[model samples]
Target: MAAVLLTGTGVTWTYVASGGHRFDVADAPDAPVAVVFGAETKTPYLTGRLETTIALVKAGKVRSVLVSGNAAGSSGNETRAMTSYLLTHGVPMAEVVVDPYGVDTYDTCARAVQVYGLRRALLVTQPYHLPRAVSLCRSLGMDADGVNAQCACGGVNLFVNEAREWFATVLALKNAIWHRAPGVASLPH
Candidate 1:
């Protein structure tokens, strides 16, 4: 058990390290799109991601935003909510692309490459999630960089998310190694 845990942790760390450097909004390189991963609607998680995306656009770091999320999930139409938030916060509607089948981190990364035809992207998510997002997207053959979105979350919620990343990282490595396609059927472009 100990060996398994240690090996998993090491593999996860390797994936995270393979992502290279994560940047803040100010230092992020120029990219064609900013891919905002989904979070619960109306939460700081969603807000921070949209806000960071807006910052990237405003700074001329990215030209468009791809909001990816599960429309049928418990988050209650995350793509819709994410699109609305971005638009209302001054991100132009013309610059927004929605992927409703982004049911998870791997799905989002996969769809970004397969469906959206993204060659490069700036991934926007909270700090804890940025590495995995970067690693997964890179594994899918996209030139992926990340910018940390600021969230006001703390206490038990933050603790749970941080803890979840360890297991999530292992899953990310598996997905990358096996070249797993997204579980959901993608809409035809």
Candidate 2:
């Protein structure tokens, strides 16, 4: 158990560290799409990501914004809320796309490549999550770079997010290598 933990820690650190200078939307690479993975709708983390993406859109840094999140059909559609927020906030509706199937970061990364047809993209998310999220998206064959949004959630929320990210980093690494399935072609017709 100790060896496993140590190895996971080492791998995680190496991967995350590769993106050490990642921060802020100003430094993000210009891509056709800014892929903003979803979190709590009203949380500063998600909202800030949206705001950054919107600014990027207005600045002509990116041509479109892809808001990826939980669909949960009509009952729990985070994508709907996110799309609505982006549209209301001055992002052109034609430029605000949603990935309703992106229930998690891994799914978001994969779908961005397969479903959304993104070869290169700018990823936006909270700072604590930027490293792993950027790492996973890149490993999944996206020419992906990232910018961390400023987060306002704290205390237990912060602790839980960082803690969950540790294990999630490991899983993301695994999926990075072995997640090939029917892929985008297999989606229901």
Candidate 3:
């Protein structure tokens, strides 16, 4: 019981401290690159914040925007959704790269760095998701920071996801050390 309480508290604080920075993509002087992952259909906060990031690029602040995620169905194509959002906002279609195979946070960051030649990236997502995403990017040798999406419900929705991220961080680090990383398409067994 005590262990559970401490672990929960630790995870909660990790989200609060490391994930609270509201990153302005255009204003981050050292951060010229930005990457936003596509969330599932229920996560409107993901798309809403993506629009803001696109606006930064449209305004000439961010040099490039990499939208990473899978397009599983007609409605759930996260990469396409992000691309369309950016296009509607006047960001050139050429400036946006759609990664259709990034099915997870680790894959999204890994593919962005390895396949896309990204050296440094500002990851955009909800606050609870920042830790795992940043860790995966670092594990893959990309200098990474994160910008949290503004949630309509604010911190309330983070309760369950924060725990999931803690486990994901451990798994991502282990995978970086032990197994094949997430982004590569396997040649087949």
Q: Which candidate is the best by lDDT?
A: 1
Best of the candidates, TM-score: 1
lDDT against the true structure, per candidate, is 0.86, 0.76, 0.68
Error of 1 at 16 (Å): 4.6
Q: Report the poorest 10 consecutive residues by lDDT, candidate 2.
A: 180-189
Candidate order by decreasing lDDT: 1, 2, 3
- Residues 79-121, model 2: lDDT tens digits: 7778888889888888888787787788888888888789888
Q: For every model shown, what is its TM-score relative to the native structure?
A: 0.91, 0.86, 0.76
Per-prediction CA RMSD (Å):
2.7, 3.3, 4.5
- The TM-score ranking, best first, is 1, 2, 3
Alpha carbon deviation, residue 51, candidate 2 (Å): 1.4
Q: Which residue segments of model 3 deviate by more than 4 Å?
A: 1-27, 73-75, 154-158, 183-189
Worst lDDT window (10 residues) for model 3?
A: 180-189
lDDT of 1: 0.86
In model 2, which runs have C-alpha deviations exceeding 4 angstroms? 3-7, 10-21, 73-75, 180-189
Error of 2 at 21 (Å): 7.1
